[model samples]
Target: MIEPVELIGLAAGFLTAFSTVPQSIRIIRVRQAAAVSAGTYFMLLGSYILWLVYGIIQGAISIIFWNVIGIILGAAVLIMKLFIWKD
Candidate 1:
């Protein structure tokens, strides 16, 4: 049986993981990199990696699932900021 905490984690994970879409859309729409900081994205990527690792260690599927997606989205943003930004 799935625990209540696991369900909560799943919900929170889904919300947080998908929350980046708006920011990414804004960046793409405006073509503006002024507000996007490379260091911040990198830090977020690093933190997500750590969270993924922790999820693996804890055998928490919710954490693993969310952080995996978070890593992908975060990396996408970081890459866009790196290549698309003109500084």
Candidate 2:
């Protein structure tokens, strides 16, 4: 069973991981990424990768899981920005 504090951490992770989803969806829906900053997404992706590596080293499941999700979401935005969406 997850303790209350752990559950709070997991919830926070989940929210943060999925926070990019709305942006991704909007980009896809509009088929435009004129306002999206590829540089920002690149930085976010790098941070997520570093966090993932640290989580792996620390054997932190929540960190690993959430960072993986964050990576995927961030990648989706980047892909749309770089390849699919156009101004």
Candidate 3:
């Protein structure tokens, strides 16, 4: 019953949402974030937050679901970059 475009959106959202997993895992495994850019993650987190808000306003479940995941994963990276890892 799902439309083709909706399926595409879901697929794209899934890809972008989980894209940060590898970076998070790497940071956790190595326990270092010298190569990570705080500013970039900051901006990315902000963008994800905005998208999440928009999704809420628009009642777009796909956007809401994927952006939540993106926010969580992105925040993990930012947190590690700012707090956990020294550099």
Candidate 4:
């Protein structure tokens, strides 16, 4: 039996992860990320890392899954802001 509650988690995770996409798109489109702060993304990445750690300790699959996605997207934005997209 599929747990319906899991869908909620999946949905939430997807939303949270993809919520960063607009900024990413903007950065890509402009080819500059001067407005984005490296510190903010670093802090966000660190926070998500902690979230993943906590999820691991608690054996919460949804939390771990979401945090992984968050980390990947956050890293993408951070990388773009710091290295690739920034002029």
Candidate 5:
């Protein structure tokens, strides 16, 4: 049985991970990565990495999985912003 804290973490992770979908879609569809901040994404990626490591250490699969996905998405956005931005 999952504890309440685990369940809460799972829900929060799911929400945060899924919430990026729309922004990602918008960036892709419009091909406008100008509004994306590389610094912010990098910071987010770093934070996620830490969270993932912590999750692994604590045996919290929810945090580990969500942070893994978040890292990927965050990297993708940063890369896209770097390559696609005209300025």
Candidate 6:
């Protein structure tokens, strides 16, 4: 059984991981990528990657799991910005 604190942490991580979804959905729905900032995406991607590596080094499953999702979402957003949604 997960401890209460761990569960709370997991829930928070899940929320943070999923926080990228709305913008992704909006970008898909509106098909607008030009408004998205490449700099922001790059920063997010770098941050997620760093977190992923840190998780791996520390054997942190929660960090790994959430960061992987973050990477996917970040990649999608970057892809959309670079290829699919280019103005």
Tens digits of per-residue lDDT for model 2 on 42-76?
99999899999999999998899999999999999
- What local lDDT does model 1 show for residue 74? 86
Provide the overall lDDT of each model, using Cα atoms, as 2-decimal numbers.
Answer: 0.84, 0.92, 0.90, 0.86, 0.80, 0.88
* Candidate 4 local lDDT, 13-60, one digit each (tens): 788767777889899888789788899889988988998999999999
| RMSD in Å for model 6 | 1.3
lDDT of 1 by residue, 1-87 (tens): 989997887788888787667778888899877878889888888988999999999998878988999999888888788887657
Return whichever of 1 and 4 wins on TM-score.
Answer: 1
Residue-wise C-alpha lDDT for candidate 6, range 55-76, written one tens digit per residue? 9999999999999999898888
Q: What TM-score does each of the candidates earn?
A: 0.85, 0.91, 0.91, 0.81, 0.81, 0.88
- Which 10-residue span in candidate 1 carries the lowest summed lDDT? 15-24
Of the candidates shown, which would achieve the greatest lDDT relative to the real structure? 2
Better of 5 and 6 by TM-score: 6
Which candidate has the top score in TM-score? 3
RMSD, every candidate, angstroms: 1.6, 1.2, 1.1, 2.0, 1.8, 1.3
Q: If the candidates were sorted by their lDDT against the true structure, best first, what order would they fall in?
A: 2, 3, 6, 4, 1, 5
Which portions of model 1 miss their true places by more than 4 Å?
Answer: 1-4
lDDT (tens digit, per residue) of candidate 3 on 1-87:
989998898898998888888999999999899988999888888988999999999999888999999999999999898989976
Candidate 1, residue 6: the lDDT equals: 77
Candidate 6: list runs displaced more than 4 Å: none
